[model samples]
Target: MARTGALLRQAPLTVALAVVALVVGVVTGSLWSPLAGRPLRADLAFGLPSLEQGRWWTPATGAVLALEPVQYLPILVGLLALGGFAEVRLGTGRYATALVASHLVGVLGTAGLLALARGHGYGYADGLARQTDAGMSAGFLGAAAAATATLRPPWRGRVRVLLAAYPLVSLAHVGALFDVEHTLAVLFGLALGPVLLGRRPHLAWRQLTRRDYRLLASGLFVLAAVEGLVTAVAPGGGPLFATLSVQQKHEELANADTLLGASIQAVLWLWLARSLYKGRRVAWRWAVALVGLAMLAQVAGLVYLAVRHLPGWPAGLYELLGNGIGLAALVVGRRAFRNPSRRRARRTAGSLLSPAHEDQRAAATELLQHEGTVNRLAWMTTWPENRWFTDQRSTGYVAYRVHAGVALGLCDPVAAREADREQLLGAFADTAHAAGLVPCLFTVTAETARHALAHGWHALQVAEEAVIDLPRLEFTGKAWQDVRTALNQAAKLGITFRVGPLSEQPRGLQLQVKAISSEWVEDKGLPEMGFTLGGVDEALDPQVRVGLAVDADSTVHGLTSWMPICAPGGGAPVGWTLDVMRRLPGGFRYSMEFLIASACMAFRGEGATTVSLSGAPLARAAPPGGAAETGGSDVAQEPGPDRNALDAFLDRLGQTLEPYYGFRSLQAFKTKFQPRFEPLYLVFPDEAALPRIGLVLSRAYLPDAGVRDLVTLARSGH
Candidate 1:
């Protein structure tokens, strides 16, 4: 009850408006009856002829009155949602302006058109001249449109889609004047959205993103072309098409010419959209030419209609005016589009981490030293596979790669303090949005996911990263038997373990390790994944050290490259993660076991407390769910057949490669150390970005994967 009181106090204006509407409804419903099926609403309702008869104030008064009690219900609800929303976001004065402006745009704009039509000989114009209508719906829709500016990400997009959809739905069911007027009112509201969002100057003509510009061009082209198509094929014609015929006359040649002209315009618009996205010089010329042609056509059409005293000029002149602003804004934003490079579009991180940016790597090293107990995967950012976005203060940095338009962040930004990490992440998101890319974070910890959520990002648990806390670990229980046996067998075979810099190793041994890696790839018949997996090339990094198991004869049996997870500023290596792990085919049965056991003991001696076995991509989730089939008034028995295909395929692949890669088994084997499990998440700016993110991630991980490769892997789990 107290909460309700507080809410009512907060929404005083909205509550007052609803109360006034209810009082009006009661007064009209009881004191008077309908004269001709419409209560005494004619006086307050707006119509062209009525306004001309000195009832010019109907626009403001009409929203307060309703026909009956039943009619008041929906109008009151609309006020509660739209009016309340606007009042809260835009304040009282601006919200009032949105309502008044949208009401007038609908009332006056429709009136002006009707008067022009009545002056001509159009048959439909006579009825509209006196067809009085009253409601708060126009104001409600306008306020709703304005309220969208205050919504958070993804919701704003959803609201825009719904607002655009209303007009399309009304146009499909064009049985009343209210439908068309409502659409116009909403468009007016959308036009005023910028003002509501605090852009006071030229609110109707604001800068638009590439997506918005392309959509506007596409929408205008469709309207012009489709109107002609409809008129040519149908008899009485649509509201837009029929308005062109003042004398109710139809001409085949006129329709044909309209279609042909609009068709060419559509083609030009699409071309312009494409080129505009690519930042092409010709696209700018095309935009000016197309917009100029449209303006000219509308001007010419309006003059011809006036000369003939006809009602119709351009059917959607209001919308054309809105699009004109977008086109102008596009011209203003010409510098945003960069010319495409000759190279094929693919994921690249080298741009920010090249030898020229050696200072960038040094900064990364400095930042890593901030965390004394860093995870083993911490050093992967210094690898060539990732790019860096550092804070202005140089207090933190984020690692990422760009594939398609998606900026896939390696994880949350790495920093000395949580506060600095947040600031860095906020800046990273801003930069990604500015570049028109979808920002996504891969393998993020729970702490990072929470921070992202606070900034309005969505996170989904993707996988679990296995980590061993070296200080607390003990190989003394039943779970440790397998590891203990591997260690014991290493001494028997004279398989001595060694750890040192890969670059400092014997050249002959390095070549042999390379041969073994090549053999493993050829044996599997699948391409090596690059994003999270490393190869011999990555092993050559100066900071990364190698671990190998070899006999007294210096014959390398197995090798593992461990990436240094060091403290921020090129500090001493504090932790290690398995990056490149391979054993020669049929070379040693327990080679991997021996190498891992020795590496842990070696890292323990160096005062490092953790080792990470990196995440396995596409190995976590089983299947993407499908809509289960309902059994007619009962619950669904089972999901559709192909619903679990992906999950099933991954499981099959895991089994097929289990003998060679042993990723899942490796995770299982690490359990003997009883490591702490950390959940990793995939954080994206919004749900709409998931598909593009998924596609880009696939290309990033498996650049050489093809239809044949997929078929081969599925067939034999290779």
Candidate 2:
């Protein structure tokens, strides 16, 4: 019942149409059997005869029939899965527009093709004109194709290639009249993809899915290979889609000119295409080699045909053209070959903490210790999974990664003076652009966002950092009543909050904290997130300080860690940013509040001016009854579905983690202390690059995550 409800809500138009079709099919003799025993087959199913006889409604009504019982289940599944998902992604009204528009074009198109074919006395066309075609698959395929625009790349592109190939593959094998209609229908669907996706992909598409450049090359590569199949099967050769002829037995090249050999090559194209889409270096190398060989063989065949006689001149020319196009495509898109595998990123991650990075780290440390950083999240600058980019002046550095053409800055730049920010940001952006990448700053504070905005970067509020002004701190207000009580109860339970570097902690105590952190991760049902977020290993960084809540038995109940916001001129730390916040399962409920309060007082005693509760990802940044971010934030400013895809994705992501992380709840807990709200923003060039930036940021944060880990994360809750 729930699943059915989901289907209706997702694709009301499709579900309604399918239900109507089933109802009509039950009454008409053409579908399954006639429930009403009516001789309605003549009026419903589409054919040239039916159209000529003026049964003009047949194109739409014809889809009501299952046509063949064996196909019914597949048609139903495709309609539900592809159509429903597209409708959900693209919205019901736009989905309907694509489906109806595609259907009308297909009906008129097939009619035109059949007429031309019949006039030419082609048996295939005459047979198709007389043959009845019925199904909603054409419309389904169209909607699915158009909806690819809503997906993130390289998936967006991969799905488009697969969908485009599906109907073409069917037409080649089946050679049925409706197969031709289905093939043409997909083109219309793809043509309307920009309208459905909200804008033209244009250069932006190439920029976003840099790894998918091979898809274009491989598509043409397969086209060149298909000519070989055509030459092997038919004597009159052209491109792959030329007229089908009787299979002929060829001389000399025994195995190479056989159907079995062509089939093997076709399967190899599939493997090569999949590999190329995944950015496998081996696949790119293989494609280049095979395309070279195929082009040479095609030239030889063309020369042989011309030398033997000009009998196959035109067809042979087309075959040569096809092979040339394939070779040219591979050469053009060669640089699009990015990663050998997902693991390639790990090998090239450039660990900030590694021996190989010592000189760079030492250099950066000296610079940062002198310049200091304003953004508390700047401490993530030292995370092992980062690549540093410094300007020529060496006054500041941006820790970043180039993933899928997106140069994602982990946080704000660490600079000696805030005044140097705009110049540094411009340099960073210019550097990224010079390298052919889109520059974006992720999980950065408002201070950095404003700076980037001054340099023409757009900002979107992502989360808010909770800052406790330690010099003016007090727990006497009504808002801090709950926090005070939690502290008192924690003292009664013998849960004392202890703070220090984990590396210098007692060995026995370190082991307990490790166990607690491990358990917390396993329970989250997802791979531990990195980049700005800290894990057990990150908590042990020599400079980071950890606070643990333990009882008399030294059993750890909860822990919090802080990363320093180095003081200006590299004098000393002026503030600390909360990093690792974890509590063991079944531990004291109030342990977190207790630990946070204790850390605040301890940091204050150490002469720290501020203690920052780091911003929560994808969580609201504003106080209750206010906008998310202070400067020009309106939550309802862009409420339409057209402008909400990124927000929708962010909302879903937040919900998925909310069950375990309770970031919103954590924010609420912070508000009880009357802390100042510091907004964070995702700074990028503009909306066109948001999706690509999103992908780059997700990968940077969760490098070790896989499909199963994400699935598990979605299913688990605290």
Candidate 3:
């Protein structure tokens, strides 16, 4: 009640309008009846006839009342909801201006258009000329549409879609005179919104990612389904239906079987839409086939009409236009729909993973057993989502995923022999090119970068790998004071560290660890990152080891997962790479430090040679003896002729993502361990692909992030 009162106070215009509407409804019996019915309607309602008869007052008078009492419900609700939102966004004065301007324009423009076409013998326009409407919906809809410009995505996109879709769908399905007015009102509002906000009328459209393409295609299918269902059920001579010739209209309304068929088609389209949204290749193929048949049928009908000397164009021209759009989208975005059905996915892994192999994940795991120790990030190639690209001799392979037309290889290619490594890089690139994909390698070690650079590929340092020699690891110096303090503090609090498989932990303890991870993810404005980053699912791998910081009460304070670093020739694990660090918000202030310190000591006890703190993307430690700042200001520039726009972009990107992912902060945190920083590079063949590579990399890391998330990141840059 308090919130409602506050909202009403903020939107006095909306509140006042609602009050006026209610008062008018009560004063005039026309609210329950047909608004003075036939004779007086021309004088009391807003339409061409009323305006032609010099009833200028009808426009203003009709705006406050509904033609029917039940219709008042939706009209009043629309005013309060949409009008209130516009008032809040545009403020009362601007909202009033937008509303009044839009209402008059919609009323006058619609009436003028109907007057011009009234004697043209066009069924839709002539039919509307005799009708009248009385409601505030058109004005409020326009105001809401205009207000949409002030909103940030995905709300901005969402509100605009709703405002646009409502009038268009209503006009097609119902075709009342007010529907035309509503449509005009919304269009005017969209144009007025940015002007009112002091922004340019031009919109800055963001580049769509693969996921976005899938979602858009899915939405188109859903819209088609809705239109079909509405046309079938309502059976009205709407804007869409009125486009049909008399004979075509007779065929449509001839039998119940046609309506049933339309209903079934709608249901089928809806089912396919769900799968398309998930990027199912099967659904894409089905939709393509269906729309292709539709287009072909339309063309055939057009030919028949021409041959028979028909008076009008073929029926369902609007449907043909929609089909053409759906077909174009299905073809243009074909790459986005890569996920096969479940059974096919099980047989082929991903669509491009390993066609002949039953499970590429197992193959990747087997290969990793031989060459995983090539780099700290090598084990990540064995993740379930990766596709394998084998070398000519099948002695080496690159683990990659196709995103935004780029075949992004993760870390170094896995090979049992050193000579096979360089060959694998060229082989992967050649294979990607043969398949018409841009090829790039991310987070590769210096050796792989050198190999690629030797082949004329460009390399840009993207991260710094932190390696701690465990044999020399000690907490004796002042630099180690923080680590020691954390260990001691945790010990004092009865907190103990355990290193093992997370799955082996007590069920309750495992749940707590997951909860801790979830809490960390939820606290961030963006989605949990993937690609090189490991999460709870990866930490649950039996081959990986997990470190837990727990109290005597069995409550877990924090946790970390360490991917195995195996030696060449499938030898025993020589070290561990740090991944998946998460802590409870207020459980222990120094839980992370305690976990890392304990993990290092434990791995050292196990005779492990080294421990990798992993790499912080878009961040690097200061050059040896350079600066004391956590993120060096001079770190943006690298000493090379190749340092150009891409470098500046990376530097800016690192700073932009700092608040969301804390890459620089993590880099600074790793510095406390006195670890050596090794440069990790992103290697690609052409500099022209840098822009695309940048977008793909962002998508790779944040696959689940939507337009709203990207917009938030852009705003954070400011």
Candidate 4:
């Protein structure tokens, strides 16, 4: 049963069709001989002959003019075997199409060749010659060609060459010259077979080698030698020197030699096919069926031929046996070369989890906490709903998503020893890797920077931290020049400055609130800055501090606010802080500076040693290297009226506010500061896990609607 299944699987179509053709041919051959002997008394032809003459109707043609059944039975069998193998490999549709087209081309070409020969007055037209033949040789060749076309890159060229060579060898039969009719038909069939149906049926070289090529080669070689010797020792002459003068005999010998070469070619093809299909597995049924059917068809053809006195029966049978052996070899070879690792990898890739799955969040969280620190930047302190965490404070790491993969990240570190930093970074990377993630680190620390370079982390963008040093923080030099000029311009307009708490007195309250309200409207735009006294009362808590600036006329000029830097115990505020500041027309520069200075003095009186003047309100300029710094300094010396105006404004604002706010105009206004820029390091568990984190964060806090504006405001210090 298994063997039967295998044979069916291997050559289902070929086996079935071959059996039908053989049965039809035998029956036809049995009945047609008697009719052929009687000859035609009148001019009446039908079937194949009618078709050849372009006539649609002719009943006699069917029985009398179909292929000389007995003579072409072996050819039909060979074709069926070849076509079946080709069909199994190439797929039924493609194989059938190629075979049908090739056969049509071959039949038409043979007809054309016959016409041409007759036109040239070349050979006698016997009764047998008038009949059209039926065989699958052309179709099989077409399938073979199609199969060759399907080979992969490495074997394509060799397969092409083999296909091309088949025709050349077939044409080498000189006996074709004497038997022009049959010769023309065969030659035409060979020529047109591949032309009309160019694609070779798809066959794995491995299977071909195992099932057919190797054994076919051996069989063909033996048959060729036997045929050559028989021709050499024919009855016309001496045992070994027979028929030396006959051109037909010489052609036969040449054909035998060509067949010998074809056998070698078959052997090579088998080897290559075997090599290519070495690691491929085949279904057991398919393997058995294909081999069995081919062998069966060939055997059946041989038996029928032997009964009919047809030549080449033994050779054909041997060829069939060879095909079976080749198939067996392929089956064994495939089993021997399979690779388990590659199969596993394919399975793994196929099963990768989708990003949107909830499991991904769990995976990301587990990956981050595997290490002590989750290194990533805090673009938004609050995380969004769709992300792994609802806030940045959550225990998971944030990762930067890039084209290659996720890059693990951490917010700039507040403080850490060099060793600690290294440990954290390494742990971050290890965690990410454990979770099958990629790692990326963003940093502004020299130590972290060096470590990143050493470890092959890519440097994307370098941003400097522009800061004001509260201890030595004073706006002076070129920085204050712009402020001083603005102050002087305001003084000319009769603008004056004062400083006090929000609830100081009626005048102070009115001026401070007005200034705050006006500045808020101007900066944030009226629609965005909607508020009234009631709204302010609702929003501001007792913990908030307010400062006001007023003109000599008691009109509000500017105002600002701060929240105290609370102690660790959360008792009284430890430091007076300047959080948000704004200014209006009258004494704008002076009042703004005064408010800051007053807040600082208040904080200092309360025993605070240092002030945290916040970062620059804009994206800081790129840092200048050695020679570039010198060039910048040179440019600063050639200041014009604009510089003078800036200087005047800073002078007035700085002097009045310096004592209270500790504000040095030169230090505050200058682009260059002497204070050290502290490093902030963003750490991540690893590089690969960054994408999911980034996607989650980006979606929630920085939704498509508010992302641009938020970024702008943050950069502008609003």
Candidate 5:
């Protein structure tokens, strides 16, 4: 009751219109009976006949009545919905004026058009001219269309699409007098909307992304299916009604063969729609070929009709034009479709293990050995699963993985020279695009993000790298109490810390490490995540160091892996990045704290100046209700805008995964080391690619996750 009261107050004009319509229907005894085929209709219905008879007031009077008893429901519903929306956006005064103006224009303009073509042998137009239609649908539709100018994309795009598609599809499949008036009314509203809203209507097709292209292709496919179904069901109707010779018209075409063909075509188009929307290459090729074939068939039909001097060539021309338009869209949107079928993708996956890829992998390793210390994640680029992108001069290379048509780079490029960093980024983008993949950089430093942003890219903070300057590090302050207690607890428990390559560790110790990691994975609902987060296989790299927390009984309580952070132009390693932390269930509670502190101390003793706890994906620290702070580094970086939708989404995602991965817990655990947070960013060139980028990121992280796993995640809830 309260909600209804609020709505009534908010939309007085809409309420008034609805009230007037209901009262008119009730007073004229048309509420429960047909308003048409009665004297009341002749006095109130608006059309060409009424206009010619000088009944100038009929358009206004008829706008309040429905043609039938059943139509009162739609009239009242439309008045409340579309009318209320327009009234809310435009206010009562402007909305009232727009409603009156649009109704008059819709009635008179459609009548004038029908009048012009009435006696010219246009069968549909002539038939509609003598008809009398009474409804407020045209007025409300126009008002809603005009109000669309006040919306923000993608809502603006969505509403405009519905508004346009309805009238057009209606006119094409079920041409009624109201359909003509509705179409004209909305067209006028769309044109007039911009003028009233103080803006000029212009197309910005360049802003459309691959996702938009896919949606367009999908919509076209559905439209084609609808057209096929309509043509099979109805003949000699609609605005593009097919005219045929007497002999051909009498030859029934709605037989088993025609219905079967239309059904198959519709099924094919629908299947293509689903696949094309996913950006499948095979689906795109099939759509292009099918649409092209349709165009070709239409052209052949037109040629045959012309050569034979048939009377219905115009019908063939309309079909050809539609097919031509569809073919053009498919061709123009070719770049958006790049995802190969699963079988083809599997075949392509073999290239990663090919001899050529091995050489690039070796070069990536070599590049990292010489320049990996530039960023802690530089060592991640050397992982075997990654594909490398080298500049033309082979000066530097970026390590990336392809997922869902995205070439997602792991970190900043490993440059042989500092000057080659930006060049490597540019080359990687070009190479990815050349291969029909969208290029995106993940977990990059502020400097790298800045370089990309300067060239018209966007950046979003995804994580915060926890860096501890070992030279200035200490475990003495009150904040260091957790570390001290953890250390003391480990000593009392007879748990010793061992650090070295896992391959160098004993067979028993390695097996124990595997058991701990495996047990950890078994405890989670989700599969062990990857991408930046390494596993046991990555920790076995002879160059990578592993830290083990073991008891006096030879049992491993917890373990950690450290990737060497090499300085550009190698000497001794300057830092170590912590990765692959795992602990036994029901084991030492302080194992993580003890292991991390010991590693930092061990690295410092070995002349390493810094130690990175590494960034936890989708986890960051920002002061309450404020921007996420990016510590003072060589380059100053600040979080993008506050309440950013993407940032909020990531935060929500982190919370969802918290129960499974404990990423946020791990981040809090890192604070015991007194590490400063450096913001890590995912940078890309276009805003439109963010949705695809998000999906690719999930795929990169959980390559083995299937539909069942996603359903499980959804059901898990917060």
Candidate 6:
């Protein structure tokens, strides 16, 4: 019931029109000669035929031409009902155009099909050979098809029901109850309707399959079947009108016995219309009047045809005027019924775009600027380094630089170290990991490494430090051969080697630093160590020495800074630490080795006995004794063989990673100096605290956490 009501509401006008058509059809038969065919001669042109013989048109032509105009009256009513309702829903002009176009196309298609059929070897060719006519049944079916296309959701099923009914009607005709051509014309109209009408509004499939729709469709199907069967079985001829000359016995049966059936159809159509109108809140008076007017026009047209037997002009003109008037009324009603609130909405939208809103631009701009700043700051720790901060002209107060692609504080390293260097480093590492940037620390001092362990920094062995007896060892023999070979290559390439202070370096020399203590230990994946570079100033301190390797063009190729090692009992100044080293472009041959040799010589000149080339900054090793604490004969305990094994493995890794990271290559290159390997121990605040460091490191480096940071930390000498 709800579904039927909804459908009726959606297409009230169509329902009303269908009812009017039925009423007109039944009334026409009652008022005019029951046996007579179509009222208008033009209808013959549309496949209808006159009863008169020798009319220039052939017998088949006359038969095919003949349309049971009564049958189409209901269809036209359906079209009008659907059209008006659709117009109400989709605007008057669109609805009107869709209906008219569909009808026109449907009619033309039917005519073309008839022509084609006649041209082909169908039996109709012999009968309709001389006839070339057209009719509006095709147009009516087309309108119905159009309605089907435009109807939405709950109403769609109703449209589908009507569409299905069209073919069934055609089948009834083919079953010998009615003319097959007429049925074909109606179906052709219906099939073309959707094409002309275009698409209906979109709705969910479930909405279209309601209970009332099923009930109504079932009832209609049963009714149509009963009508078909009655017409099929009923005999022809009636005593009330012996003078009548019916074309078929079925026509006589329809005229004599189907009055009650026709009346019932008319009543159902009216009920559908009334239900639709009521649901839509359309004024009952207007609906009633409109229906009455349509009925009157249909009656007037029928009466004129019955009395005058007028030519084509009267019937055509009457139909044209009547349809035009009906369309006008529909248009007026639609305009009057439009929602005022929708108009107000358009006005409001227009107001927003007006010049009065121009002042809001400033506020919008401020909001955008704030958002951009917040987003930038939020993502600041994400990269290895802040590329944006490198630009001196950058406006924001926040600035950063990548120390080997790891983001670190520029001015707050001390604060970070105090608060928790490990946490800060972890944040930086996490940010870098997320951004796919490599997180690394270069030239980090022992103190910083300790701080990293305290906060949680993992280490892996990359290379051994090559401490040389500066005063005793000479750069000669097999060692000299290697140095000479490197020098000769450098000489041919016009490369030079030079040493310089931090202030006297060429523009090609690049400098970077890692704080010994800062809130950056979390990324290192090792417990923190208490170490601080807060008191050390590399540029001004006399205890520190900076070494440079440059090419012939005076371009710095590599550099290493050295500082005195702190020891007890009046420090002996036994070795100079390689605080920093870098390879400059176009540097001297054996630049790295040369830099170490030169630094060793300078330290010897300074009365130093030995040089601490420095442990590989990145190195790690597994615990000794085959993953267990007990020392066994099976495990070679040659001063922690497990540590040596891990170092050896990292040495291989350094060889592999050398080409990619220059620092890794430097670590490997330093091996030729034959410095003693040392084990670097990470002293965490507590052993149980390692997992926290590991978690932060995992989030920061994921799969590479253990391999890069932990391995490097574990292999480094304490």
For every model shown, what is its TM-score relative to the native structure?
A: 0.63, 0.71, 0.56, 0.30, 0.75, 0.27
Please report the candidate that would top TM-score against the real structure. 5
List lDDT for all candidates, in order.
Answer: 0.66, 0.71, 0.81, 0.42, 0.80, 0.40
Worst 10 residues of 3 by lDDT: 627-636
- Evaluated at residue 716, the lDDT of candidate 4 is 45
Model 4 C-alpha lDDT per residue in residues 123-201, reported as the tens digit of each score: 3222223654434555566566655444443334454444444443333222221123223333433343344456433
lDDT order of candidates, top first: 3, 5, 2, 1, 4, 6
Query: Model 6 over residues 288-332: C-alpha lDDT tens digits?
Result: 355467556766755774687543333235334544544444333
Which runs of model 6 end up more than 4 angstroms from their true locations? 1-464, 487-500, 504-543, 551-553, 570-572, 620-664, 695-718
Q: What does each candidate score in C-alpha RMSD?
A: 13.1, 6.7, 11.9, 26.2, 6.0, 30.2
Tens digit per residue, CA lDDT, model 3, 86-148: 998899999998999889878998998898887877878988997788887889999999998
**What is the model-wide C-alpha lDDT for candidate 4?**
0.42
Deviation from native of the Cα of residue 495 in model 5, angstroms: 4.2
State each candidate's clash count: 13, 1, 0, 78, 1, 80
lDDT of 2 by residue, 1-718 (tens): 9858875877788788778766765665435653222346567767677788898998887776766656667777888888887788788889989888877677668887787778565555666777667777888888888888876544576677778776665565346666777787788888887876668645342243343355576566565456456545653322232342333123423656677887788889877876775556777788878867866886787687668653444444655675677667667767666445535543544322112365666666667767887777777877766667777664788877667877788777888677676667878876565344678888776677777766656676778888778988888866678889989999898888889999998998899888888888788766777777888788898888999999998888899999888865677889889988888789888888898899999999999998888887778846765412233432223233433556666766777778767777877666766777866777876455667766776677678999987776656622
lDDT of 5: 0.80
lDDT leader: 3
| Residue 623, candidate 4: C-alpha displacement in angstroms | 7.6
Better of 1 and 2 by lDDT: 2
